[model samples]
Each structure stands twice: as structure tokens, then as C-alpha cells.
Target: MLAGSAIVFGGVFGFVAFKNHMIKQFFATMPKPVVAVTIAKAGLTEWRAVVPAVGTLQAVNGVDISGAMSGLVKSIAFESGQDVRKGHVLVQLDTDVEMGDLRSAQAELALARTSYDRSATLLRSNTVSVAALEKAEAELKVRQAKVAGLQAQIAKKTIAAPFDGRLGVRKVDLGQYVQPGQMVANLQDLSLMLCDFSVSQKDLGLLGIGQAVRMTTDAWPGVVFEGTVAAIEPLVDAKTGMVSVQARFPNADGNLRPGMFARIEIERPSGAPVVTVPASAVAYNLHGDAVFVVREDAGPDGKTVSKAERAVVQLGERKDGMVVIRSGISPGDVVVTSGQVKLEHGSLVSVAASDPLKTAAAGAVR
Candidate 1:
């Protein structure tokens, strides 16, 4: 009786296993769910290649205007923020003491000349000693030197512009006592602006003088300023490992100012064929930076179906919401721009009629 009962249980278990196998086979033959995704072809798209760097706008020539002589300010020769030429007087200090010294030196010089004439006449007649004539001649020289020294001192009291530029707000007022080398105002030659930034050592070789640079600033929204590379630092910073670069831009209207923050993009010449895709095509995760490429192949039933496959890419610079694909993907491969979250290695996908990647990237920063 025990053997017969064991046989019955074994048959029941086998029947159940066969039914489960048939059910799994039926589902395996069924079509997979299609995921709607936006796709873009990774192709040879020509874009203005650039190396991005952050920098500050500066004047080609700028300095803080200062006085050279210590004295009470007598007058101001220029208005604040006024344009001036080279040698234009910006400030004038009291020169009364210097002028008085100059007059005294002149009178003393005349006295010495007269004494020298009388002593020389006496010497010819042997009435005065030779030492007396030499003394008078030495006195004349001392007086002449004093006069010249006073004149130079008086000239320095009048501060003049070193170059053509606009003066900043006056830092000294009339009757205010200012010491030597004290700043009186600030001046800048804003006709041409210089933008200075740093670039990495790896990218330093790609830059050169006269390459076009485009810039924009938050201070002036929707406005673009252009320039050319003026200089590159010969040595890289040992600690930071960056090289300095300078660019110049014409500022005829004086729109650009020194110390303003600016974003810079230095143009790069075309070289090898590069593949690019929309920025949305890339997915960042723990595995690595990658993109999902669409593979169209025959399904089990001989029908065309798109499968999402992951491809690791080495990324280059980002420009205008487009990412440069350095490696791991071909030019003609189709990449999913959106709806990549639901994708797996073999996820069945369908291409959306309209590509939404461009719309999603309208205001995105590259």
C-alpha cells in the first residue's frame, strides 16, 4: 500500500512540471514590449571646436594715478572720469616754496658771477689771490645746480597723465595734504581690453596667438564679445598645473571693463573626423560614462526590432549642448537621446517620431 501511494505522488509532480514548461515556452514566443525613445545619429557634425576657460576682463594698460611730490593739493586739473591725453595735468600741488627757492638761486647765481668777474680782474693785476677767483667760480656752479634742482622739484608737483586714458573718481581734494607716491586717482586705457585666463598643461599646445576667442559675461546678458589670443604664458604653474593665456578685444564703446568676470572659448582648427551627439544621449552612473546605442535586428519571428545596447565613450569638450564622442562609438551609430532610464542591454525600443532632445537642450549649458 505504501509503494502505490508513493507512485501516485510522483506522477502528480511530473504533470505539474510539464504544464509549467508549456506556459514558459508560450510566453517566450510572444513579442517584447517596445520602449518609446528619442534617437539621434552619431555623425560627423562640424562644430566650432573650442577650449573653455574662465577669465577676467582687464584693460591693456591700467594703473592707479598718483602724485610724485608731497605737498598740499592746490588744484585739480581734470574732472573725475574725464578722458585725458599723455602729459595732461591731472593734479597740481602747491609750488610756492619751490618757486621762491628758484628765485633765490637765480639771484645768488648772479652775485657769484659778478664776484667771479671782479676777482678775475684783480688776479690779472695781482691784487687778489688765485684761491679767491677759484672760490667764486665754485660758488657759481653750486648756485646753478640749486636752481636746476628746484625746477625739477616744482615740475613733479604737477601730476600728469602717463598715457591716454580715462581718470577714475578723484581720491584727493583741493587743500588736502598728500604725501609722495600717494594715489590721486585711477586711470585705465579701455580702448582695448585684455582677458586673462589659465589653461591646463595638456591643452597649452593647442593654443596660439591670433586664434579667435568668444566671450560672454553675466553682467551683460545676451551680449557677446569677441577677441583674439594675444599671449600665452611660457611657464605653467607648478602647483596648479595651468598655463596663463591673454586675449585682447577692442572696446571702442567702453562696454567691457577691467575686473569683470568672463567666460572664454578659444577656437580650435579642424583636424581629424570627430563624432558627436546631443548632450542628453550620455548617461552618468557608477559603472562609467556611457551611451545607449540602438541596434535594429530581426526578432525571433523575423520582424525588425530595435534593441538598446550600452557603449562606453571617452568624452571630449562640451559645446552648445553637444558632446564630442572621443571613442567607443562609430559615426553612423544611432544613440538614444532620451528615455534611457528604462533601458537595459537588450531592451526593445521604438524611435519616437519627433526628437525631443533639441527641445530639452534649449537652455542647457554645455
Candidate 2:
């Protein structure tokens, strides 16, 4: 019975050994799984840091054209949306009454001048008393003042453009009565535009007069309007701790209008070299921002293979879809920009056929 039991045990042990050897051989022959991913080489680039803010565009010179005096509109001199120069007649109000008064005052002034001349001549010959000559002189001055006032009244009724600008729709029509301080139309100088925005007090030091600025508006997408820092408020807001900044942009084409919402970017005059990569490569999580770096290694079969290794990185500003990598990776390192989901710490990887950014753009169009 002992001999029979030994034989049975040996047979069972042999069977188990053969099965394990066959399984090992089968696994060794199979290929390792690899993930296909898009990658970009980290490169050194100028670190362009920008301070972003939102603001509203305003014409450098803009105002609601209003009337200084009330009268019936005799004629409209400019059409709606007309470009006008300084002192261009915009509206002419009826000035017949003032003109009539001016003529009467002028006739009185002529008589006063004659009387003053006669008084001076009489005083020279002692033909008139000193008091009488002085009284005649005062009367002549009063008449002259009356004539000037009437003439000014007539000029006030004829409203004209205060500056060179483009006019909005005409609010006053011919024969319509307009009151003093009432808006006749809107006038704006479109040759230059100004945008007022606020930035944190800490960034105030980064700003200066003539610093380069860039702006974009919903009205003109994909078009960048270049400008400069025109003015910086000397005082910071006590409540918000923000400093007001004004940028001036050239708008010779008149594309920018007053009150249009704008996105502004103030560029730093100086920059440092930094390592950069596509923005898609970053994986943000509770732990930290990390990127998958591609590395080459020898597989078990003595064949070279690419592997993905997670690396934590400190990020800086992002511009033009590329992000500045402040730490963790150096220039010339390959990073996975897309298809990172299938990767692990040492997962095998292969370069994808097409760029992920290009693919995404194409997909968006579709």
C-alpha cells in the first residue's frame, strides 16, 4: 500500500509541474499590450506672462451732441452717420428774431457812437460840461454791449460740431423744437479707442505708460487690436484694492465702438526662458497637476519599448494653447499630450499617427 501511494503522489506532482511549465511558456510568447498616444516634445520658449482683465471700449472723444439753446430746428445740416469736422454746422435753428434784435441794437450803437464823438469834440472846446461828456461816453458803451449780446444769441441758435467725429442718428428734425441741453445726436471720435479696466494692486507695479497691450471684442472676433497703457490711476480703490488702468488703441477703421465689451491682455515687457508643452498633457487632480512623460526601457525579451511615467509639475501661465511648465520636466523630454487615460506608471506606449490637437480641431468642425 505504501508503494502504491508514492506512485500516485509522484504522478500527481509531475502532472502539476508540466501544466505550470506549459502555462509559463504560453504567456512568454504573447506580446505586451501598448497604448497608442499623442506626444509632444517639451521645448524651451519665451515665457510670456500676461495679466488679463475685462473692460468696455470707449472712444477717445465721445459725447452726446446736445443743443445749448432752445429754438425751432430750421434745417438739418448733417445726415445720420456722417463724418464731421470741428465746427461743422450740424443743426440750424430759426434765428430771425435774434437777427432782428441785433439790427435794432446795431442802429442804436451807431447813434451812440455819433453822440460820443460829438461829446469828445465839445469837451475839447469846453462847449459841454465834464459830467455831460462822461455820461455820453457811458451811453455809447452800453449800446455797444447790447449789440454784442444780440449777435451772440443768434450764433447760439446755430449748433455745430464740437470736434471731429462720426455722428450717430440725428435726433432733431427740421422744424422740430429742441430744448436747451437736449441731445441732438451722439458723436464719437473713432480714430482712437480707450478701454478702462482694473487690475489687482499687486500688478500695478507691472504697468507703465506705453506698455504693450492687446484687446479683443465680441464685435470683432479673431482680430487683435494692439494698444498701449495710456494711464494708470495713482490711487487704488479702498474697497476693492484694485487699480484702474486705461489702454489706448488705434481704431482708424472705426471697428471698435463705445461701450463694447472687451477682453484685455497686458503683456509683460520682459520674459524668461521656460519649458513648455501642449495644454492637453496636464491632468489636474486633488493631489496635484501631473504629466505623463514618455521614457524608453528594455522589455523582458531584450526589446526596447516606450513607457509612460507620471511626473508632478508646477505650471505657470498658459498662452496660445501651450502651457509653461515651471518644474518637474526639462526641455527635450517627450510628454503625452493625449490618450493618457490608458496609461499607467510603466505602461507600454506608441506614438499615435496624428496629432491630438489637430484631431480635436477637425472634430469640432464636424
**Candidate 1 local lDDT, 52-152, one digit each (tens):** 89999889899998877899999988998999999998888999989998999999989998999999999999999999999989998898898889999
Highest-lDDT candidate:
2
**Which regions in candidate 2 have their CA more than 4 angstroms from the true location?**
1-33, 354-366
All-Cα superposition RMSD per candidate: 5.0, 6.5
Score every model by TM-score. 0.79, 0.84
Clashes of each: 0, 0
Collision pairs in model 1: none
Report lDDT (Cα) of residue 204, candidate 2: 86
TM-score of 1: 0.79
Reference-based lDDT, residue 14, model 1? 89
lDDT tens digits by residue: candidate 2, 206-308: 8999999999999888999999999999999999999999999999888999999999998776576778888898988799999999999998879898999
Off by more than 4 A, model 1: 1-32, 47-49, 117-130, 209-212, 221-224, 297-303, 356-366
Span of ten consecutive residues with least summed lDDT in model 1: 357-366
lDDT of model 2 at residue 314?
97
